[model samples]
Target chain A: MSLVDLSKQVALGIDIGGTNTKFGLVNHRGEILVKGSIPTDEFETPEEFIDALYEKIQPMADEYCEGKEFEGIGVGAPNANYYRGTIEQAPNLPWKGVINFADLMTEKFGKPCKMTNDANAAALGEMMYGAARGMKDFIMITLGTGVGSGIIAGGHLIYGHDGFAGELGHTIVKPGGRKHWSTGSEGSLEAYASATGISITAKKMRAEFPESVLNQYPEEEIDSKTVFECAKQGDPTAIEVFRYTGQKLGEALANFVMFSSPEAILLFGGVIKAGDFILKPAKLHMERNLLPIFRNKVKLVFSELDEADAAILGASALVWEK
Target chain B: MSLVDLSKQVALGIDIGGTNTKFGLVNHRGEILVKGSIPTDEFETPEEFIDALYEKIQPMADEYCEGKEFEGIGVGAPNANYYRGTIEQAPNLPWKGVINFADLMTEKFGKPCKMTNDANAAALGEMMYGAARGMKDFIMITLGTGVGSGIIAGGHLIYGHDGFAGELGHTIVKPGGRKHWSTGSEGSLEAYASATGISITAKKMRAEFPESVLNQYPEEEIDSKTVFECAKQGDPTAIEVFRYTGQKLGEALANFVMFSSPEAILLFGGVIKAGDFILKPAKLHMERNLLPIFRNKVKLVFSELDEADAAILGASALVWEK
Candidate 1:
């Protein structure tokens, strides 16, 4: 591959997901070019995941930015912590010990690097590009398999004292209630609000609506999409499941809005694709639960970033900082 | 007072509260020198409130530091916002419009000035001279009539986009529970956890156990103190109230820990005066509900700052920035 023209001012954005690893070139403005993704194969350990991803990405970097300018690398990954720059015991990737993933990138690419959780990076992405553009303060939530979120206050991602500052998912929405079984993390809206959460709610609704279309779906295969498709088809049980998810989500967000008083909450992830069935209830419930001061004040909007490019753009934006 | 040392760089701390307005002089280290307070007379308007406070405070400043060397002034008020240097409609105070309270002091005192909310000032006080000394990040919750709180991240007060961050008291634990009525703000922890919150719980428990000694006290007069006294006397109702308050407090804080992941949450206010009755249960409930990653990690500690001195010193310290 031709060496990309040297600018020494751009950055590499890397997003590591449960299923795929995405890469892109991003600037400080949150702009990206030449984004691509490769599968994240099941690795027995962290070593294999790192080696496989680096092998796939190194050539792409050489081709895209050959003799081109690049400053640093930024990564967004599950369980990635800004403080530690590692994915610590993340369930999806099958990594246990602290992985110095950023260091590995730096060693291979010889660039300054940074990393944060995918949700947090998405938040940064929105701040720099998508829905929350020009916004200094906002909360970004990725409601996928589980409810995950990030907080930006005063134009910076709030890492709190520890790097784990934006765990809006685990903020208890329902006490003593069945929530996402997040490795023993209890009372999270994630269990009831995410795709996994909707599945759980759908599973419970089986007893409530035994003859519904949901009865046809096997227990192991009941993802949010299946339920959403059923809801789209006017399946009562599926519709009810989405409503229940919104209720829990709205209630949880109302609680979160108090602490951060964000200008808006940018919603991303696969589950939100259900659109108003999920959002209408979530918005109504959120507004219902909010204080008069915050009523109709906090904007809850959907993410505009292409699902695939979000990771790389988010991670790259970190190192692409102006 | 003869011309007080003209060369001394002393900072004036002005803490404006509903009941009274306190002003004190201090060095960089936050040691109180000319400490005093004047009654904050009831006012129908914000101008009147300021006029009344300035009427008394101006003379005192004239008398004490007329010819002495003085630096800047710092003001802490309920609705005060540090970014805009104004106090908006504070819940406790009868003020409505934007009042340049900081400018009022600086113009009168002939010095530079700083201002922030009471909770934020209290947080700063902890950072400077209290239990949070040397701590870069922490949350300060004052369990008074309302559960007011302050957040400091990376050693800076986290005033959100519009300087309206850190409303910890209002984070809802129960969707529509006890605190719903009293504040009329909808499901606030402050309704159930503050001193007045304890009173609310106690009053409800009082009806359940009217035969108890609480019957001797007027229902309206049964405040947090009465409840604490009852707890000291081994009253089951009062004890249960404290336990419940602790549980509620813990749950809310557990949510906060998820977002902030702070080193600790410093408990303050007269409500926390019950000590272990409140702290122990709060700790237990927080631990029980916390995410696994934060199981025994985040510490819950007490504020050692003298309540009066803390706010006063906090206002003073505002001008005495780090």
Candidate 2:
């Protein structure tokens, strides 16, 4: 009954982003043995990207997995479909139409491959090795370039009818307010609560309050980081920006809580680094808006997964599902 | 091979409302063989209510299930908890605090019993016998005294952590717009789209436009039905009320669809009787608010279940689950 011997299985994890594609070999304990990345825009077609990926990954796979058999491959990408194993019309990606990423990866690596959107992979990562361990129902909200959500109900990720459920970022928080990036919908959660949204909020606040310290920074330099820097220096306008972002996020989180009623909502990625500035207002507003039944029952916490290794671990976790 | 001989099994369905409590003996096919109701306010205590319910239901159970063994009992009440078999601080119920209703009913009838909130029961009923049959992911919205919702994801009703999931009615549709009845939240979906809310909208429109035909009806007489009549007669203000209500509902529904990505959203209860007056505007607004991927994928339709029998059948579906 030696459990140590059984824990030797490993998987290859791939995270395909707009600018770069990161790939790594991950063990059962969520530890990455080796990882590397390539410029995604360097390739014109999905086939070309796959060829470059194979050329780069095969050497790492051979070196890292010399004594162990690679169990499978798991991929996290933009607009990925878990059920169909395809990436369809992803706005950020160069490829058009549907790309059968899993089939191509499986054919190249000679192992089963599973794929899902990045946020969902983060959700799985949290469940497997981070904040959501041993929890059945929770939502993971990633506030990076855009706001993305992965909803887990009854301990299962909800892929819905077309493998595209958990699109909470697109849900409207303020109707007819701010226009969204891709959807063009007014006042979506992404329009106000994302990293880009935070920067936009900072820009708006700078214009509104001419006397504020944020006015010193050029429009291009006034990003989420600059807002944080200004807030640390006790700038009123910069502080208000985080508060506004947090309130919008908190209200949307309340709506999401009412929808699925998850036990906890784990906040992930860049903006969460704002810490109490964002979290305090977000938690306050979420609690304030909740119905009596739901109030005080849900936990709003930052994701515990390591920022650098989370994607690979998350993608590798998908192999365990298989 | 003679399945007809074994098809005589029946279950008791109970729907506990603020004013009245309805009970029925139902078969697997969702047929109510015998049904009756009692004034819920007649009993000051839950024990008294249970006694009266037993008295009325036992006779029906014995008569209808003469040769066939009575299977179980299912109760649908406001603020019911499926996991705990209790009702906690229900606003409309006479009994306050927590009541182990399912255990009480099971103890009283000497049969297995199951209970859930009315909306969740309605969702189960729809999956088993109504518009949601053969569909794994869909939402059921009941627009009666208040707006309530039942969310089905991956073929199971989402009970969340506290057995109080799918409270879509309470989700904010118009921030800081209209105040809700119970929760007192401003601009919740229930505040603008429920039967009560629709009437309130009509009253507000009448006040805004003094020359409108809706001003002819006494304020007290302006119910959903009266609003419908007024709109049919080409009352611009009345028509505007339905349009406003539908827009709010459709926007909220679009948010819900994005969250869960359901195959359809089934509208149930009284307000939906307005038909195209509400449906057309709702459909338009929902499509308008939806993200590009979700725009045409979701179907918005009225529940096909018979209005009178739906509650009982929905309650009975809980037993089938047990």
Candidate 3:
């Protein structure tokens, strides 16, 4: 009823990471008009962090959104609760306890704000702008430093009753298997399927296989990227590392498949760059473990969103979700 | 605007089991006015089964709905597909291959029909008429001859992309632990959590623990009921059987909780009769496995619906869901 053109609206998207924060002004068509970053750990408090973000982003919003109305602000962060609009006890983040993130953002920006966990935001991004476009049901698993997941069903992201659903990374895959380095939870998917987990595997495997190319690198430098490089050069032990990682991932994927029966499982982040070394075994074991009804039906694919801009895009997508 | 009395509407609910087919006329308030059953295995063909079902149900419908309008027919069967409205390759059911169940029901009854798997129906029943009332997110696990599960997220039953979602029973818990009797899948939740699994555990544990009261029972007679009786009589081996089953069930439950973050997990069927013998250990293990944020939050409870009327009530829930 008002004269303001809703079609020319733009949203301010913020991706709050432990090390760095990315902010962008995005249009309705999923295009980022302007973007910038700030080191997240430099701030002593959340208040300081918000001030720093506002200083950098306010000018960009003013410049890029001259004729357009500001839709709102959307944020993605570790341990962020969509229901409570707070970040609670995020191990990776600088914050010590629950921070009323959405309220602070809304107060500073003078606009409505929405927030969810980073994994869930990424899933929303995938659903809106990436491989899962038009898909009503799908799961997004990010195999970065730590494994993270977001589940979507019936064209909506599953926030659970607590706004903390879809913690597939924390789901125990192997009972009494590997001990997680940080959480102390044994046999969780994060203990084996993560980039950190892959590095641990590489170190252990290289110890057993001294002649392998993985041994050529220093213990500190040995990681998923080095393992992938070695596997590309046809190193047997390096290839074996990915096979083992993929087997665990596949077995976990099969369990996930039975739980949600998503049309496809989209893998994202650094570990997915291993390509066929990981994908082939993951596909094989996933199919091997699935029931006859589920077998060969679920598609396993990589995210189509450009990795550099995905976080900002994912955060922005949250604004347009409704 | 149609002038038929909407408040007096009733739905015909059918629960097709492997051994018996139970049907009832249920009102909008989840009250079953009349109910009856027929042997499911006696029929050679699905057509004969449908004819027999019609013969018994049509008269009940007519008597119960003298003034009330017939809303629709709702069927809960093994391997029933909500999307396709078909029953495909159900091992327990007499009919083989895919039977167009919903279409056949509509043609025979001259009413629109809705269908879903029995587990999903039970979940709907629990949501609408039982313990899960007013709960948008909960899981219903049926631990009878086999473990069956239905997941409800955001107040709607999760049918997945293919209408075959929420098969928590088939999700691998033990990895390489136990072989299933029929499916041959190794280490599924069903292999350890079902009543059949309890019997198997009883037989296995009683062998290891010689001089236990479980040793007195014949191998064939040592079912879940027998185990419960022995446990009540202070038999350690029988008690251990429940503990082991509950441990496995709890571990799998933690995985489910992580997947959907349901507020409550409602346990149904014969296995729940073990009471604290299973509940205590299950609670302990489920809590132990969950991440710090999820611990001690999800309420694990038993189904509130009377077992005798649950199936019929659950089937009727589908009709009123919209």
Best by lDDT: 3
Q: Which 10 residues in a row give candidate 1 chain A its minimum summed lDDT?
A: A2-11
**Estimated TM-score per prediction?**
0.91, 0.96, 0.97
lDDT of 3 by residue, B157-250 (tens): 8999999999999999988889998888899999998988888899999999997899888888999999999999999989999999999999
In candidate 2, what are the lDDT values of residues A1-322, reduced to their tens digit?
A: 6454536788888898899888888887778889999999889999899999999989888888887878999999999999899999998899999999899988887999999999999998898889999888999999988988888888888889888998899989899999976678999999998888998889888999998999998878988898999999999999999999999999999999998889999999999888889999999999888898899899998999998888888888888863
Residues B165-260, model 1: lDDT tens digits: 888887788876764554466667888898777887888888888777776798777888888898899888888889999999998889888887
Model 1 CA deviation exceeding 4 Å by range:
A1-8, A29-31, A36-39, A42-52, A216-221, B1-8, B42-69, B210-221
Candidate closer to the true structure by lDDT (higher is better), 2 or 3 = 3
Rank candidates by TM-score, best first.
3, 2, 1
Candidate by candidate, in order, the iRMS in Å equals 1.6, 0.7, 0.6
lDDT tens digits, residues A185-294, model 3? 88999999899999999999999998998889988899899999999999999999999999999999999999989999999999999999999999998998899999
Comparison by lDDT, 1 against 3, better one: 3
- The candidate scoring highest on DockQ is 3
Relative to the unseen true structure, what is the C-alpha lDDT of residue A130 in candidate 3, on a scale of 0 to 100? 91
Tell me how each candidate scores on DockQ against the true complex.
Answer: 0.65, 0.77, 0.86
Ten contiguous residues minimizing lDDT sum, candidate 3 chain A: A1-10
TM-score of 1: 0.91
Q: What is the Å distance of residue B67 in model 1 from its true position?
A: 8.7
Clashing pairs for predicted structure model 3, backbone only: none
lDDT of 2 at A84: 98
CAPRI quality band, candidate 2: medium
